[model samples]
Target: MMPNTTTLLISAGLLLARPISTLAQTTDPNVDNADTPFIQNIRPDRPGQTVTTNMLHPGQVQLETGILRFDPTDASWGTRRTLSSALLRVGFFNHIELRASQGYLHPLPGTSVFNEANPTVGPAGFTPLTVGAKFLASTNQDARSQVVLLTEMTLRTGDASFLNKAYEPAIRLLVSQQLGARYGLEANVGFRQRGFQAADTKLGQYLGTLALNGPLGGNFGFFTEAYTTWQRSTRFLPGLTSGLYWRPLPGLRLDVTAGQQFGNLGTGFTLGGGLSVRLPK
Candidate 1:
């Protein structure tokens, strides 16, 4: 099992800092000589809604984009489609990074765009802009484990009819552990407050995720995950997703995933793929 990074890092950082801080208070010339070389940190998003606990090195940039994403609509209109940048990450110093995302919506109404049960129900628009920050609290290369925290704000700047027109915010804590050279485990827990108006803020969703990922061979990998949610009226909703990923060259990855909800209220399936590229600082 991989080491628990958040726990270890908090400990290690304190130990690493005590001496340095003590030296800083002195006139020691060697205090400035503690430059540790950096090892490569590579983590990509896509193929799952659960983000991983990894951060780019300072000055690095990563693009996570979807070529085409589609979901079967219960409505007779057809499948909803989109082409979008799911996320972009840029690393600065102090184990922090900037993130941005937007998706173009093209909803194909099965019979009508409005939910027949409730004419008041509609869909989100072509463009939903989300901006966030990701912080790496800890990483342990020897143990191959990491921990990360991410927070995002969804801006209601898209087509008003397609959006909730309210600011939605979310936060997630991610943990990853490498079981072996061929196997790994990850888990996530998060909360999102969505569709709130002015002072009516409430917990809209409670999320839990777990996954097992392993390599298929060189440059090829696969992962299967179960994502669960607890909501107000629906109570509990469960979903499963699986995908394969390939790397044809260094710093580039491609992935395809399909997901479906499971329950009496379950409806259609979702299919999407993503491409990611990393650029060095």
Candidate 2:
């Protein structure tokens, strides 16, 4: 049997060689600080569009639950509210982990475009379930810089009007770099397979995001980000997001996030809050 090179890199970072006594004896008292307690070297995705290259250690588990609201100035559907969305991640190996996410989505009481005329349709709307595998491709010895890849599949098991009944798959690349004592940069590029209903066309889009994060004295952290979606035939849909993370406990992180879209048509804004809870590794 052969060990995976990427896996080796991740282990080297998480399970560093520094002895406990040595780290404790260092002159810099905040050498071990991180943006969030749930993650080792970076903040989670709750409050920003940026995805971290860091992953949970083996036997570690985390749950991210949040509420999100989107108000589209021109959307015929009115407003959309996600009462709750949950992402569960469990580390199965040194550099490999699995994630499952599905958030509940529904329109404000009177603002639904879904057709209730068809009794066969079970529910009004819900986000499709998605599952993915995250693998660490590379990481520095100190865990200050890292690269990771994620492959995901979204099942078309939601309401008929809301889902295209297509098994959409996606791949994302995440990179992280530490610029200074308090600044960290993250970049992401991704591709997804998408198909629509009624429309005879199949579609695909490229997703990209860049973000910067830093600590804000006290148990808090801040981040700003820009992200976009584009295809060859369509104009880019861009958005800017910013948020803050607070660690009230050793294993829990809380966050609030907001984003505004910049496009000629159907522009909108979003606001949300979430919490991450990490279990013993």
Candidate 3:
């Protein structure tokens, strides 16, 4: 019989639990360090909502982008679409990077550009800008554990339809624990102000996300994730997503994902596909 996802997760955890001493005995230091490539593999923050803990090497730049479609519970609102959801990252000093993201969400009737119905909404308009930075706080080589911190601020410059008309700030703590050699587990927690208005300023939205990802074979990999958002007065709004990824070259990756959101007011599903490219300086 085929095993369920829970069973598979449990099995992977067990595999990752093997004694560290046993793993150490199999390592050859010289062999492991013999080959160091000029450019590292591209690490993307796509196919899922949870941002990864991996940081780019110094002097490297990366662009990750894709298209997305969301089917809302209310058919009258129509399927919301994004033509170019993109994030650009530039590595600066060691363990630090600059980041920015922008996307165009097709205008919808009677719906705010960013509504509670969909948590995956992206920033729109040419003027409004969302900028951020990431820092690698700490790392443990033996356990392959990483802790990263991110801070972002959205400027209130943009088209009226797309502007929240205020400074929106956010922060998140991201972590990644490698399970064995092929699998990894990641988690994130954060909070952000959606708007500067009185109603939106009263309570910030909190986010929590967990994900498991690993390789399937030679050039293919997969990931499954669960994420949620909540406020002081509201229940948790959760979602699930899974997808496959392929690497056709050393610095390029392509991926596709599908998922659904669950909420009290309404529910919806999302579909997306994108690519990431890393440029070496």
Count residue pairs with overlapping backbones in model 3: 0
Give a tens-digit lDDT track for model 1, residues 133-161: 98887743223566888899998776554
lDDT of 3 at 73: 52
Which 10 consecutive positions of candidate 1 have the poorest summed lDDT? 32-41
Index of the highest-TM-score prediction: 2
- Per-residue CA lDDT of model 3 for 1-281, tens digit only, reads 35688899888888877865567755733233212221134558776779888787778899998887886554544556444588999988867889998776565555456545663443344546789999888842223677899999988766555434677889999998766555778899988896657787558888899999887888788889999988888888899999998987768899999998998443567888999998872
Candidate maximizing lDDT: 3
Each candidate's lDDT (Cα)? 0.69, 0.72, 0.75
The sequence of per-residue lDDT tens digits that candidate 2 reaches over residues 49-74 is 67777677788888888887875443
**Worst lDDT 10-window in candidate 3:** 30-39
What TM-score, over all chains together, does every model reach?
Answer: 0.73, 0.76, 0.75
Clashes of each: 6, 0, 0
Off by over 4 Å in 1: 1-42, 67-83, 107-125, 139-143, 195-203, 264-267
